[model samples]
Target: MNKFLEQALLFDFYGELLTDHQKEIYEQFALEDLSLSEIAEMKGISRQGVHDLVKRCQKTLEGYEMKLHLVEKFLSVKEKVSKIDDTLAEWECEKNDPEEMVKRIRKIADAIIEEL
Candidate 1:
């Protein structure tokens, strides 16, 4: 994964655990694509302070992912769904019995739902 995409996924999974100030700064830096100096100027803090806060937020989000594994599980499920879609596409081209494909897809979908 790209570094920024990984950070965005981590934030999406665990952002609610952050303080509002942390969330705002992180969103500005990560989602809004603000430079550290830009965020510092907007937030009325020194550039180093903004940098430190962003680093802290990344560490906190990574710690939560390490403990909870929600991001890992989500990626796994996403991969499985992609596989299911690929299977369906293959089945369409091969003109195979749809029953088996449907059953396999359902099983994968059910497992994903269970993980959630």
Candidate 2:
């Protein structure tokens, strides 16, 4: 995944755990695409301070992910659902293989259950 996208996902899953001040700075730098200098100017802090805060927020979010794994589980479940959708779409076009479709779907569903 892209670094930016990875950061965004981490923030999405664990951002609520952050303090209000950290959330505001992180949202500006990570989600709002603000530069460190810009965020520093807006918050009346030094550019390096904004930089440090953003780094700290990323580390904090990563720590939460390491402990909780919510983001990992969510992505796994989402992938499984997508596979099920694709199988159904394929089955719709290849109507001759109902048995195969059922087998594939059941296997995917079982994996999803295991994940949960």
How do all models score by TM-score?
0.88, 0.95
Lowest lDDT block of 10, candidate 2: 90-99
Residues 16-94, candidate 1, lDDT per residue (tens digit)? 9999999999999998899999999988999999999999999999999989998999899899889899988999899
Global lDDT for candidate 2?
Answer: 0.93
In candidate 2, stretches whose alpha carbon ends up further than 4 angstroms from where it belongs are: none
Q: List the residue pairs that clash in candidate 1.
A: none
Candidate 2 collision pairs: none
Against the true structure, candidate 2 reaches a TM-score of 0.95
User: Which RMSD values do the candidates have, in order?
Assistant: 1.8, 0.9
